[model samples]
Every structure is written in structure tokens, then in C-alpha cells.
Target: MEPAPGLALVVVSPRVAPGLMSRSAWQVVEAASVRLCADADEPLAVAVTDADLPIQVYAAGSPALLARHLVERAADDNVVWLGSADGDEGLSDAIADEVSRLNDPPPVEVVVGSWDVPGARLLDVVAVMDRLRSPGGCPWDAEQTHESLLPYLEEEAGEYAEAVRSGDRAHMAEELGDVLLQVAFHARVAEDHPGQPFDIDDVAGGLVDKLVRRHPHVFADVEVSTPEEVAANWQKIKEEEKARRPGAH
Candidate 1:
């Protein structure tokens, strides 16, 4: 089966096989269902019996270590011990009898689903700017000049820095997206100038070309010992290009 996206504690048997079960021997269970015991918490010890398989417990956080632990546990035991997959039948039967005797209760009310989300669409910031610049469009967006908007770049960069400092990955992701939008906004305004490739694609393509040229170790036959060597070679090539230009002395 395809691996599940989130965290899981999978049980395995010896010889790296799924433990004996009617279905998949190694079934996936919610981590909350599996509990860890500390020796400090309980002085008395509990031992598993022949009815149980050798238990191999592991969390998604460390798959390599988990797998190794399973292998090591399986080496000493006959069967892989997963959790208590088969609960006590005698206790279950007694519970079922008592449940059958009890009267049914009324169903509780539950309001389903959400209503807040409207929708979303993709549009180039240039198109957004052009619309804003139109005679009938937003006055606030249209009235702003490049000089008035200069601080937005720094503001967005600062937000990005704050997000990084928080160490909350999800917040950082959202903040970085805002920084990217600011970059695209600047690029859109710069595109109005003639003889300048000021679009985001132009910026990206230039970086890609420069990266490929500089990484001789990765993209070309030229060998480079250190990053310093790569930087020196890049400067030499750049100087040669400048010297070849028509206005160079």
C-alpha cells in the first residue's frame, strides 16, 4: 500500500514480516492509541506472553531508527509483537451484553462544514496594476507612485525576517510568500522602462544562467576545488566580458 502522509506507529513481526492478522499484519493505527511507559512511572513490571507477537513500535519522526529497532527486536523473538490488536473477547462480550440492555439516547445536534471561504484566482500582478491604473479603477492603487511605495519592499523583507525568527515553519512559509509578492510588485513597476527585462521570469532566468555558468563542478567539465576558486573564475570571466564591450578603454 502507498505510505500514508502523516505520522504513524507501525507494528511488525520477526523476519521483517507483518505480524499474523486476518488483514494486513502491519496495520496503521493512530499514535494516540499507542502509549509509552516509563520505568519511573511504574515500579512493577509487566511481561508479554506467548499469545503476543514480538512488538515493534516506531514513530514516523525517525523511520530509520524505528526500522533498526524492529529488526533488533525481531532477532530475539519468535513472532513480531504489534499492540493488542485482538482485545479480550470475554471482556468485549460482557460489555456488549450490558450495552444491549441499555436504552438508546437521542442524537446530538451538529452543524456541518464551513461558510467563510469564497474563492481564489490567479492573475499576474502586472495585469492587476494595469487595471488599477485604468480611469475607472481604484484611486488609492492608481494614485501611488514608485517613490511613495519604496518602503513596502523593506517592510515585506522585515516581515520575512520576523517569520524566520519565530521558528514556526508554517508562518515562515506564509511570510516568504509575502516577500515574493513584494518582489513581483517591484518587477511589475520596473517593466514599464524600455530596453529592460524587468519581469520575474527575466530575473529567474538570469539567476539560472549565472548559476549554471558558475557551477562548473555540477554543470560542466571544468573542475573547482573550493567555492573561492569558483568565485575567482566567475570574476575573471565577468572581467573578460566587460573588456570585450565596445565602450571599454
Candidate 2:
């Protein structure tokens, strides 16, 4: 007798663009006899339908009912469940409970479609800053200006320094996050500058350029073995950068 078809639950990261899934995820999604999702308007679901694949969107219901439906459907044909970005809360446990009752349950697998890359959470910080400054967002955040935020910036920096002095790693991390919030807030305020508009990306890009330019030992052909030599190289790069400035003599 032929074995029962399996079910593949595909989970994707909201940080990643829709339809950009892993090879294994695409394979299971393409091979599945039935594709299911809770919402038709979800990013992944829209992407799947845009690719001309037939996917059925079930109305919002209880997790147990969804789990039962998935298991029953998987008995005869392969099934693919496109998980939501916020995660299909409680659905996995429900499925586990449903399968446990079956004497001969079909195999079930969770396929990771996409994952967040390093520093991906920084995007979330930027997004939050944007929302806070936008209309209908926080009134205080919207009203903040770079000049007005200077006191906050100084306070956060002082707190971070105190955290470092106390040798408290957790406090240092929290204080560092506060410092980062000040940076994001200033960048958001900068966006409204009429003549010199700049965002967080511009701030990051400049920092990236400066770091690459100074780190010749890592990025370029320059060779430096000792920390002293690296420091010397950094100072030399800084001097060169200063000399290249518009008003530098």
C-alpha cells in the first residue's frame, strides 16, 4: 500500500520580501496538492497567487478546527500551509494534538521559507521611528526636533557611560538601546529639514563609508598586524578625510 501524503507548514519572515523563499520551501509549495492560508491578503499568500498557484484562504476560525481540516486533507494528498508573519498562534500545538489521536498519522514538517538576516531588526527600529514621526502617530514624537532632542541625547549617552562604568552588561545593553533611539529620533527629525533632508539610511551609509575607508587593513590591500599600527592607520585616514573637506586648508 502507498504511504499517506505529508503536510508541509511553511513559515516566512515578515522582514523578507514576499515570494523570496528557500529552495526547499518552493519545492514543497509547488508539489502540494492543496495550498492553504488563513488570509488571502497576506504578503506570502498574495505572492503565491501572483505566481498563478491556486491557494484556498479559509475564513478565520478556531485553531483546532483548522488543524483537524489540515490533517484530514493531508491523509490523501500533500498539503502546504502558508503561515502568517505574526505566526499562526496555537495552530502548531493544535495540529500536534490532532495528529496524536491518529493511529497512523501522516508525516508533518515545518519548512522555513525565509529568515531575518543579521541587523534585520535595525529595519524595525527605523520603521518605528518613521511611524512615530508621521501624522496620527505620537504627538510628542512628531513634535520633537533635533535641537530639542539634544538634552535627551546627552542624557542617554551619560546613562550608557554610567552603565559601562558599573560593569552591568544588561544595563549597558538597555542604555545602548536608548542611545540608538536618540539617533533614530534625530534622523527622523532631519527628514523634515527643507534644504538638507536626510534619513537613517543616509546616516548609516555615511558611517559605512567612513568605516570602510578607515579599515584599510580589512577592506583594502594595506597590511597592519599590530593594534598600534591600526590606530596609526585610522588617524592617517582621518587626517586625509579632513583635508579633503570643502573648507579644509
Structure candidate 2, residue pairs in collision: none
* Pairs that collide, model 1: 13-80, 53-80, 53-81, 54-79, 54-80, 54-81, 55-81
Candidate 1 per-residue lDDT over residues 1-249, each given as its tens digit: 333222222222212212232233223321122222122112110122122322233332333443333333323322222222222123323323433443641111111111122311123454565666567978876566567677877887898899899998998988887776666566665666667647656876788987887666789898889889988988887887689889998
**Candidate 1: where is the Cα deviation over 4 Å?**
1-137, 194-197, 225-249
Backbone clashes, candidate 1 = 7
Q: How many pairs of residues in model 2 come into backbone collision?
A: 0
Q: What are the per-residue Cα lDDT tens digits for candidate 2 across 1-249?
A: 333498889999889997999988887888888999999998999988998999998755888999999998899888889998779999999999999999999899999999999989998999898998999899999988888999999999999999999999999999999999999999989999999999898999999999999999999999989999999999998999999999999
Model 2: lDDT to the true structure: 0.92
Worst 10 residues of 1 by lDDT: 105-114
Q: What are the Cα lDDT values of the candidates?
A: 0.45, 0.92
By how many angstroms RMSD does model 1 differ from the true structure?
A: 19.7
TM-score, predicted candidate 1 vs. hidden true structure: 0.39
Clashes of each: 7, 0
